[model samples]
Target: MKSFDVAIIGSGPAGASAAFELSKSGISTVIIEKETLPRYKTCGGGFVFRGRKNMPFDIASVVEKEFHSIDTYFSKKHPHLTTTRDQPIITMVMRDAFDNLIVEKAKENGVTLLQNHKVENITFGDTQILHTTEGDIEAKFIIAADGALSPIAKIAGWKETRTIIPALEYEIEVPKADFERLSQNVRFDIDAIPYGYGWCFPKKNHLSVGVGVFTKTNKKINLKEHYATYLQTLGITEILSEAAHGFVIPVTPRTDIFVQKNVFLTGDAAGLADPLVAEGISNAILSGVQAAQAIIESNLDSEKAAALYTAKLEETILPEIRIGAKLSYHFYHQSTFRNIVLKKYGQFVAEAMTDLFMGERTYPADYKASVTRKIKEAIF
Candidate 1:
C-alpha cells in the first residue's frame, strides 16, 4: 500500500487543477488516471474565461483559438444577435491537449501521477483507502474529481442528482477555402433544435458542431439524423475526417451533503455543472481548485474542509447554476418567453451569460438584481 496526502481520481480539468493546486501547496498529491496522457475526452472543447482566470500558470502557448465574437440565433424569432468584446472572452482548444497540459504542469511541480490505474473501490475511515487495479493506496484525504458518472462517488455513497442533457458532437474536417466562414463565429441556435440548441465552434482545420437537449421526458428525436440534416442544410458536405461522439451533461447542482468524513467531491461528480448552457469545463476546474483550498485550509479537518468547500461553491458557482437551471427551464418550457427575451435583448443575454462564463459575474443574486428587476419594471 502506498500513502499520500491526497489522492485524486480522474485526470480531467478538475482533477488536474486540484493536483496542480495541491502541488503548489507542497502537499503530497497523486493523480491517478484510468487512461493515458492526452486521452480523448468527449467535449465541445470550449473554454470559458472562468477556468482561465483560476489558472496559476500561463496557457497562451496552448490556446488553439481565442474568440471575441459570440453569435446567438433564436430560430423561433428568426433573430440573430452578435456580441463582441475587447478581449478574448471564450476560447477553443482540444480537450486532450488542454487537459494533458495541466497534468503535465502538475507533474513538473512535483505531483506524482499514476496512469492506467482505475480506482475500483474507496473506503473511508481513519484514513481513506483507495482500491485500484494498480493496488491499494492510502491518503489522508480523497478528492473525487472523477467525472459526472463517478464510480468513486457511488462507492462513497454520495447522493448526486443529475438532469442529463444528451449531446451529440462531431468533429468534421473542412476545406481551407471554407474555413474562414466557419471560423468567423461561434454560433448557437435555439428553437431550430427543439429542447436544446445547435452550436458550431471552430477548431484548427475542423469544425465541432453538436446539438444537445434535455432528457426529462425522453423524446425519440435522433441526434445523428438532426446533425446530418443541419449540416446538409448548411451545405457543409466536404469531408476529410470525422469522429462522432455522444455524452451526457449534468444540469443538477450538488446535493446538500457533498462531503463524507475523509472524502470530498467536486466537478460533475458532485453535479456542479451549469444548467443553462450545459457548460462544465470552467465549473469543473473552479470546483477542483475550491475543493483543494478547502482541504488545505481545514488543516486536514474533514468537516471544516467539507463546509468550506461547499461554502465556496455556494458563494461562487451555485448562484450561476441556479440561474442557469431557471433559464434552462424557461428555455425548454416556454418558447414564447424565450423568443420574447431573445428578440428584445439577445446580445445582452449572450454577453451576460458570457460574463458569468468569463468569471466577470455570478448567478442568482445578479439575475435578481439585474434582469429580474428590469423585467419587473418593464411589466409595471
Candidate 2:
C-alpha cells in the first residue's frame, strides 16, 4: 500500500490546487488522476480576474487571451451593457494546458502525481484507503476534488442534494472574419435561453459557445436547439469545425456534511460553482486551498481538520454562494420584475458584476434587501 499524509482525487483545478498548497507545507501529498496530465477538461475556458488575482503564481504562459471589458446583451428590454476595467476582467485558457500548469507547479513543490489511477472505492478507517485501478492508496486525509458528478462522492455515501443544471458547450472554429469580430469582446446574452443565458468565450483558435438554463423544470429543455438560436444571435454564419460537450453544473452546495470519515469534499463535489455565473474554477481553487489549510492547521487531526474546513467555507465561500443563488433566482426566474430593474440600472448592475468578477467587489450580505431598497426608492 502506498501511504501518504493526504490524498486528493481528480487533478482538476480543485485537486491540483490542494496538492499545491499541501506540498508547500511539506505534507506528503499525492494527487490521483484518472488520466494523464494535460488531458482535456470541458469548460468554457473563461478564467475570471478574481481567480487570476488570487493565484499563488502567474499563469501568463497558459493564458490564450485577456479582455479588459465584457459585454452583456438583453434584447429589446434594455440596452447592451459594456463594463470595462484597468485590468483584464476575463482571461481565456484551454483547460488542458491551464490545469496541467497548476499540477506542474504542485509537483515542483514535491507533490506526487499518480496518473491513470481511477479511484474505484475507498475503505474508511483511521487511515482511509483509496482503491484505484492501479493500486490502493492509504492516506490520513482525503480531499474529493472531483467534478460535479464525483464518483468519489458517490462511493463515499453522499446523497444528492445539490441543484444541478445541464450545460452544453461547443468548441467551434468559424470563418476568420467572424472570429475577428466576435473575439474582440467576451459576451453574455441574457434570456437567450428560457430562465438562463448564452455566453461566447473566445479563445486563441476558436470560440467556446454555450447556452445553459439555471432553473430546473419537468418540461423538457432542448439545449441544442437553444445553441443554434444563440449562434444566430451572435451573428455566427459558418462553422469550419466544431466539437460538442455536455456537462452539469452544481449550483448549490450539498446540504449534508462536507467531511465524513476523515474525507473532505471540495470544488464541484461539494457543489461550489457560482450560482449566478456558474463559475467553478475560482471557487474550486479556493475550496481546495482551504481544505489543505485545514489539514495543515489541524496538525493532521481528522476531527479538527473537518471543523476547520467547514468554518473556512462558511466564512468565505458559502455565504457568497448563498447570496449569489438568491440573486440568480430573481435575475432568471422573475424576468418581468428583473427587466424593470435592469431597464433603470442595467449599466450599474453590469459594472458591479464586472467588478465582482475582477475581484474589485464582493457580494454584500444584505444583497436582496439592498436591491429591494433600490427598487422602492426608484418607484417612490
lDDT of 2 by residue, 1-380 (tens): 88999999989899999999999898899999999888999998888899999999999999999999899998855779999898999999999999999999999999999999999989998999999999899999999998999998888889999999999999999999999999999999999998889999999999999999876556678999999999999999899999999999999899878999887999999999899989999999999999999999999988899999999999999989888888888888888877778778888889899988988788888887888876876677
Q: Clash pairs of candidate 1? A: none
Q: Each candidate's root-mean-square deviation in Å?
A: 2.2, 1.0
Residue 100's C-alpha lDDT in candidate 2? Answer: 96
Tens digits of per-residue lDDT for model 1, 73-155: 77633657777777677788888899999999999999999998998887778888888899998998888888878888889
**What is the TM-score of each predicted model, taking all chains together?**
0.93, 0.98
Where model 2 places Cα greater than 4 Å from the true spot, the runs are: none
* TM-score, predicted candidate 1 vs. hidden true structure: 0.93
Per-candidate Cα lDDT values, in order, are: 0.81, 0.92
